[model samples]
Target chain A: MNDYLEIFNLKKVYPSAKGPQTIVQGFNLKLRKGEFVTVIGHSGCGKSTVLMMVAGLSTITDGGIVLAGKELDGPGPDRGIVFQSPSLLPWMTAKENVMLGIEQVFFTAEKEERELIAEYYLTVVGLADSMHKKPGELSQGMRQRVGIARAFALKPKMLLLDEPFGMLDSLTRYELQAVLLELWRKNKITAMMVTHDVDEALYLSDRIVCMTDGPEAGIGDILEVNFPRPRDRKAVMEHPDYYRLRAHLIEFLEVHAHKKKPASTVPAASPAVAVAA
Target chain B: MKETLRKLDFLLLPLLGAAVITGLWYFSSATWAGDLPNPTKTWTESKPYVLDPFGKRGEMDQGILRFTWLSLILVAKGYSIALILGTPIGFFLGLSKTFTKAFDPIIQILRPVSPLAWLPLGMVLFAKVKGVNISEMAALFTIALCSMWPTVLNTAVGVRAIPTDYMNVARVLKLSRWKTLTKVMIPATLPYMFTGFRLSLGIAWLVIVAAEMLTGRPGVGGFLWQQYNALVYEQIILCILTIGLVGFVLDRLMSVVERRFKTA
Candidate 1:
């Protein structure tokens, strides 16, 4: 396949009292199957907007998204999304929430088989004990775990997470990130995430695609991080190439991207290289 | 002693207020030579109803419980009809902005117009049908007609108040229309629906009295009218007390139901 996921000259404009306002323009991206990519940008830089377009949740004023060989008309069962909040139904138990999505995706499957699949994914997210708890009763991290379980149980061809742990504490964020990493390692499904967190993008992503600020934001930089798989947080942080890549991304955000801040002073003369381990 | 006091917290204040009101009524009546029956006279007169609540003597000797139950039964039938018809319309109004924009003005205009205003029309429509008593039918139609608005409007408002995040989740899941309605929309709207329901049931009870009074039927309202016409002030006092107490109980029943049907 030329590209497992392709966004060709994507554009989005929302109509307002001031006439059409363009949020994104000339946004081009491509992803290989099983690639973990994160889009980073300033707030209101249209990263979430672009992700919404990919998830087929928002209308693309122009351009198109092609997944595998087919173009998307609208949202379908093939893409699973996790939002910033857990987004589990307050009225439903975690197990029921997972079952709801899995049952839809595996509509032809027997009821027992779907139930097992739901339970299996919930267990994978370490929510086996709390599977029957409603969203409100569960803590925030547990709720997001259920959200992740619900998304994964659908067995979508790709996973799309829009800052799924943005509202979480750092410890909980790390915990969920590890859980997601384990699931991704086992399933090897393509993943696309949107985050403004530089360390989060670096720790979890194979490639980080950063966008300039909107209105009319588009791709500014694409960095490939080739740290070995089954990576640990401490191990990734200790990698020789990690700091170089981090500094480059931070520089891009501060200088080239909109909303410039006081430059983080870096060692003057370091060889520019992408360490493809 | 503390436990008893805590228990008394539930009963004491309300009981005290009732006693004070009764004392005031007695004091007022003793001082004034008027038709308004005092609390003691009403209690003495309604002793038979309190003692044998299910007694029946046709129009002249019906028990207080029997009259209350008759009104309640009519309320049950009319309220069911209201829910059946009103809930679907409310859902449609909530779901479609165009429909809401078109029909909301008409609803507002008609809502404030008392359901009693429809009595003549109901009389014409429910006129002496085969297998149906015309007066009873008219009373039910009037009560249902009035009671439905609160439910319909409340359900619509509830549906509209649902957080957009839930709808976004629905969209992302690409849930089928039927599934969305059953699983998401109905449950999400339920809390608000209950508020509307409590309000509607109160109004239903309120309108039933007027409906029965107008139709000259077998209910508490009709009994009140009979006592009024007969100039039996003590019996009228008894009927008024019965109506107030029944209305309070109906409201309390709705509160219990609302607590039981929690969304979370």
Candidate 2:
């Protein structure tokens, strides 16, 4: 399952008043099947631009993505997306919102089966009680739960998240992270998440791809976390290597991510950063 | 008890307002040679029309109910025609900039022109459509053409106001254009469309009264004109109440639908 998801030399340029402004350039990543990856960067670092290209929701000015064996031409149900805000249809109940995506993805599935699928995922996200409530009627956390439920119900080949909990409070964020981690472990679906929180990346990802700030941003360093599976956050935090990795990521974000010329990082297999004095 | 009181608050103000208005109306209309009929006088004068409201009392004397129904039918047919034509055109105008650029100016210019002003055009057009001199067709055309503005404009505005994030959600889901329209555009625009509908119905009601008065049609508006010509002040007052009450009911109906869709 190597190269299960391949993003090669991706670039994005927006038409501006002066001229075309590049947002993501030479951005690259590869994921083996079932590996959870998170792209971490500062605001305006084009992490979302990168994830959007993978989701086939944005125009790819220069590069391409190959998911499994198929090239992504445009948006399809193959890639599920969970956005930062609760982007559920305000008019539809949480259950109905999930059902809408499921119906679109599995158009041929029986109505009863689709209802069951929506119910199963909503229940998974602890939203079974609120599933019948509309987006406006639910709390932000409950709304995001519906969003996560909708994406998971699609059962897509890959899930792309655009800081799915960036707006939530820290406590709510932690609760949602646990729910998401449990779901990811159960399904083992290849996923790429965009985030700013270093702890969040370390908590959820098997690999962390840190990115530099962009007019043309690219990957700064790829850090692999080899902590054992069915991991406990408390146990992981107590481990010395976890602190090492955490400090490593924070440094990259502060120094490497902001410095703009992080293209000189060591090879991907080095497992360490060694620059000449 | 608190919930009951809260509900009662809604009706209290309206009832008080109505009572005040009625008191003023009676106090004014009770004066000698005021040339307006008091409520009691109108009720007494309307006893024949009210007792047998649907009666076939000769040609000019078709009862109040029959006249009201005829006027209502004209408004319904004309308003229905307007909705059927206006909504899609408005939606397309909202979605397409070029279409709006070309068509919107004409719509704007035509929108504010009073429904009464369209009488001449309706008369000319319906005098004989393809050599067919149709009775009541002219007034119907005038009513329809005049009242179609609100739904069209409001629907367009509704489409314009849809949040971009919702469209992004639509794209990420890869929903079909049909689904995007039905699931996104229609529901999102429903409240706005209802606003337009209420306005359009009001305009249609106004236009129907004026149109029927001129067309010599057997309706409330025509009846009002006849009673005016015969110097029957009480019947004229009754006609005013009939028109006001019906208009209020029509507006209320639309608002109910609006509230349901909005809060849903």
Candidate 3:
């Protein structure tokens, strides 16, 4: 499959009084159309920095990203992002928050059509009952649900989720994971989610891109998961290779998470490691 | 029973305060400030103006309400002008660091200036214009000049305080400059703007009395000044009380509006 989204030689550097501080260097990734990819690593691994760069919320200091054969410029409705926090407008209702993006993406559509689009997505995210509530009035999980609904309602070519369920409880996280998977299964939009959650990466993504810990973080390893489509939590957990794959992910994280190396000496290892078949 | 007592206390406390203050005033007037009329004497002397607020006898002897109405008109005109001018200046200040850096010192210097000082400048400036009410125009100019700072400062602060997350959302949605401003910036800045407006209106009301006193326009402040010159201290007191009451009411109205915006 041709690459639907390509990020090449990505680098982020911030100037400091001491010297230049390099956060991420020589990062590269490619996603085929409709691929679900999650970048996982320890905290402060610059995973989110990479995601923000792709989302065009952060400036790219070096390298480039090309999505759907178009060189990315800045943030646009073509790319939808769900931030770590819900980031919904506090004054706007849940439906209004979703409609904010929908109105921009579907500018040519009629008002009723836009309303329907917002309503449909909010309902899909299980916010049908509280669609009129503001972010302040909603629970943390429900707020993130609105955020998810907002991103999906845009119907963008790519979705970038920066730990969308990071603030939620485990139960809410599981529920949102189901909601996200259901949406992704239906839409099959190319997605890149940044997370530190191991099981979350395993359950949701086709490929898990792990990064070495930062100040100058790069892709430490890549693991492919080939669990059957429309995966059930019970069946996947019960699968024979589940613990093996889970062990491999945990082991890779433990080895590379705290190990810092100079950027010049680190080789760019080939990342096409199919750990599961 | 406890809740009812608390509610009663709300009304009773202020009434008690009024009574104590009136007693103190009567005592002070009887003792040291002998020229200052007692509360009973003030009410008697100012009764016609208080009871018949809308009466029209002559230009100078018109009802207290007529003078108050005139002062309110000037304040309304000045406050409106202040909002129209100050709101955009505030947005610019909030949006651009360069603009703020250039103008911030100037705003700070001008913000503390009294309406008394502005009144003379207004008179001199409007003195050049043709066929306009010089005193009224000077008074309006002074009120607007003095009152606009709160609105401008508050609005700028409000704009600057918009969450980075909201801006990120705007960028991700690729909203147009206009849409981003109208949808995100304006709504986010509204509560702050109202706070500024509330303060601005308060300042405008405060400035109007001083402005009217200086310009000798027929308003509450002018009435006070006129009564002072005429040796009718009771009517002066009446004007002062009216001004305070009106100011309190205006502030309450602005706060109500501000609260509505905050929750909306």
TM-score per model for chain B alone? 0.90, 0.86, 0.96
Error of 3 at B208 (Å): 1.0
- Per-model TM-score on C-alpha atoms: 0.93, 0.87, 0.94
For model 1, which pairs clash? none
Consecutive 10-residue window with the lowest summed lDDT within model 2 chain A: A268-277
Report the lDDT tens digits of candidate 3 across residue range A104-215: 8888999999999999999999988999988989999999999999999999999998888777899999999999999999998999998878899989989999898777
lDDT score, candidate 3: 0.88
- Considering DockQ, which of the candidate structures 1 and 3 is the better prediction for this target? 3
Worst 10 residues of 2 chain B by lDDT: B126-135
- C-alpha lDDT (0 to 100) for residue B19 of candidate 1: 90
In the range A102-217, model 1's lDDT, one tens digit per residue, is 87888899999999998999999998899988998899999999989888888888999988888789999999999999998898999999887899999999999989867888
Writing each residue's lDDT as its tens digit, candidate 2 over A1-277 gives 5889998899899888999999889977899999999998776677888887887778899988899988789887788889777777888989988988898888899999999999999999998788888888899998999888888889999888888888788999999999999998898899999888889998889999998867788998999988888888898788779989999988887785446545444222110110000
Give the distance in Å from residue B41's predicted Cα in candidate 3 to where it truly belongs: 1.0
Off by over 4 Å in 3: A257-277, B1-7
Q: Relative to the unseen true structure, what is the C-alpha lDDT of residue A208 in candidate 1, on a scale of 0 to 100? A: 100
